[model samples]
Target chain A: MKIRHRDSDSGKIQLEMTPMIDIVFQLLVFFIMTFKVVAVEGDFNIKMPRMSAGGAPSDQLIPPLRVRLTTPQDPNAPVCGIYFGQRQLASFEDLRNEVAATVGGGGPNADADEYEVELDCDFDLPYRFVIDAITAVSGYRDPSSGQIVPLVRKIKFAPPRQASGG
Target chain B: MRYKKADNELLEADLTPMIDMTFQLIAFFMLIINFTEAEQDQRIQLPKSELARPPEQPFEVALTIQLMKDSKTDQELIIYGGEVMPLANLQRVLAREREYLTRTKRSPADATIIIRADGRAKTGVVQQIIETCQEVGFEQFALRAQQEEAG
Candidate 1:
């Protein structure tokens, strides 16, 4: 009996492109469908333990500066007035200036823990206004250098007011 | 005069460059594609601030709590794990989350609760959520905000 070998030298074997092309198209479609255009997001971190569990650190040089955000009687009102220690600030800009002045030209490596701001926000005041107040006190964008000047990073919310439903 | 083309020659379109380009595009998309489940709800408009830069280090464990305030009805809704609940009923949901964390061998104290709240949301409600988290043994929090566009 003679052993015969199969033909190993078959002419140029055509590459199968259909399945690969199909898979590639499928991936492309999947990626295009899931592509979401989102604005870059950031976080302002807070470390608040329960009041009963070791209240607050006492290494502060000064007492917490009280920044109050008040609103009109209307439930849907934005922040109407921002008072920094009894003195009413005209706007968030003024609040930022007031904070910068009080903190003595806060720099990049300023002692943030020593200076604290307690946000005493009104029950009806919008949360954005509180964020504005926080941004104003926490830091500011320096125009000349286009850098953030660190002011007070220690921010705490005053006790929650009466729940106004929303 | 009539010219006849050769019938034996097969006309073949070159697909190498097209496949190469397609593969390049796929590679590019894969490189830039974000797979992380970022909870960016459309209903809540984030507050923008110049100081709000992305954190340098990603939190090892994070739980996102979304809050939406209806402008017309003035109703507050707490959204967590794809379920919407009222603010008054959110403490129960938070307690469950703490349980889940512990079951998975993760300490609730190390987890950062990321709050993506509507700008119009009531501050009191937000504080209540934080307080609830505090009671549940989570101390860390991150107030999410949009990066301010330069004026």
Candidate 2:
């Protein structure tokens, strides 16, 4: 079958690569802009605490106060306690008292509609203690103002460790 | 006159289509840009963990603990994020913050505390930071970590 028809006259079968090239350039630009240079920070040695359900605190909008749990270097004593700013929480009663007093001190301005408690606990601390402390702080009421308020509403847990295995 | 002109002999590709594609790519990049300039050190490679999840909402308020290496040694400690003060001071800070929130009638839990530390940091150092937050009655905390993005 020898049938040739003058090579179809003009022979113009171009793929209009201009549009494709434009798209490729566009994609390149998109990737360059969207490319997030993520810089990983923190100790690469320590294994973070595995959270089951509530996992790591994911909400940044919720304000949390930092608390550190420490036992004095004395190995013989079980004097593990809480440190808020720089003071130790000697007893649960003290926490209770503080919460109650603070609420009371709010005075005429005290209102339940505007109060909350933030809890930040250490990873190694017994879970029960944290709960107990939470309860005490949460169930506080101002005696003088007669205003009941939950000390904490949103909780953000701190990282388990700062450095590697201590 | 016979070879005078061939109609449509300009042979130029229409540029509108190409411009449209370029615009699309630019839009995509703009969407993924993270504008928050967090001055974090790059040398510190964060430990990779499955636990790393970006926060749901930007933390509007936070109690920050800036951990610094002992200029003299490798030791790390809570430096600029509230240390060497009476627990009362913490209570005061919380109370003050609470009091302010109360006046505005905002939920007291509307804030977060970010505990930032060096990667070569120690557990004990971090734990101490947590204790401080607890004493002032903070119940929540967030430990930061990172992982390599897989191809």
Candidate 3:
């Protein structure tokens, strides 16, 4: 004997929403789990000249400005001393001011082309200190526009110095 | 007792609202996701700098090197192409990269080397890496740093 339903509604079609919702939720969860918010990263472009065994000595007119970074013997000390040539700088601000002065007062026609800053850092000095010194000597803020103008485009790294006994 | 049946009614839940919410979530995730995360190593904490500026133009060919300190040995380890290696191995890798670039008719000067060193890492280690890169004929260098807010 054949059995038939009395209330058969086979002609109407319905889309299954459960599975679709399940997949969508899964995708949302995946994306949310993988999402990472990171701080903006940038780069300071530099040109590293090829190292040569020997080169002829030339008569150079201007000497590169040297910035020496000395770290305390105590590893726990967070402060590092910044020096501009023979003069010790009180802070990064002082170093920046001294750099600006040496670069002819940050004028429009200031001869930044002839300026080069040599960063001589101790072997134990943290990388943060080197970048801080670079920031101090590399550029200056424009008082009028509040924009950072490049002062010394060229930067050279001197041989790392051994940390002296404090 | 006999019961009389009422009219049959089909119940449905609207899926439009659910789909709209999912799409909104997808958009938010897409905006925050970083495709360049592979180039960045979470083990390395980048130094913060106010002078760090975004590149004027993206380099067509760039190599990223991540430097981090080994917690166990307290020695600097260089991570290149997701492989952690010592300085000698890194130098060899750079040499190979330079050779590959030369074979592909690309100038070593055109290829940019981006160094991402930890903030607390010694400056001398980074300097040595630069010196190694220079020895391998890489002229263009980019020091990666996080952009710090100016006071």
Best candidate, lDDT:
1
What DockQ would you assign to candidate 1? 0.73
Instruction: State residue A27's C-alpha deviation in candidate 2, in Å.
Output: 14
Superposed model 1: Cα runs more than 4 Å off? A1-11, A52-61, A72-79, A108-110, A163-166, B1-8, B103-107
Off by over 4 Å in 2: A1-35, A39-166, B1-13, B39-44, B54-103, B106-110, B147-151
lDDT of 1 by residue, B55-134 (tens): 99999999999999887887779888777888777778878888998899998898999999998887888988888888
Better of 1 and 3 by lDDT: 1
- The DockQ-based order of candidates, best leading, equals 1, 3, 2
Quantify all predictions' global Cα lDDT against the true fold: 0.82, 0.49, 0.81
* Error in Å for residue A100 of model 2: 40
Question: What residue pairs clash in candidate 3, if any at all?
Answer: none
Let me know the DockQ for model 3.
0.67
Worst 10 residues of 2 chain B by lDDT: B43-52
Name the top DockQ candidate: 1
Off-target runs (Cα >4 Å) in candidate 3 are A1-13, A52-61, A74-78, A142-144, A162-166, B1-10
Q: State in Å the error of residue B134, model 2.
A: 3.2
lDDT of 1 by residue, A41-125 (tens): 8989877777622346545568889998886576455446889998987788888888888887786455767788888877777
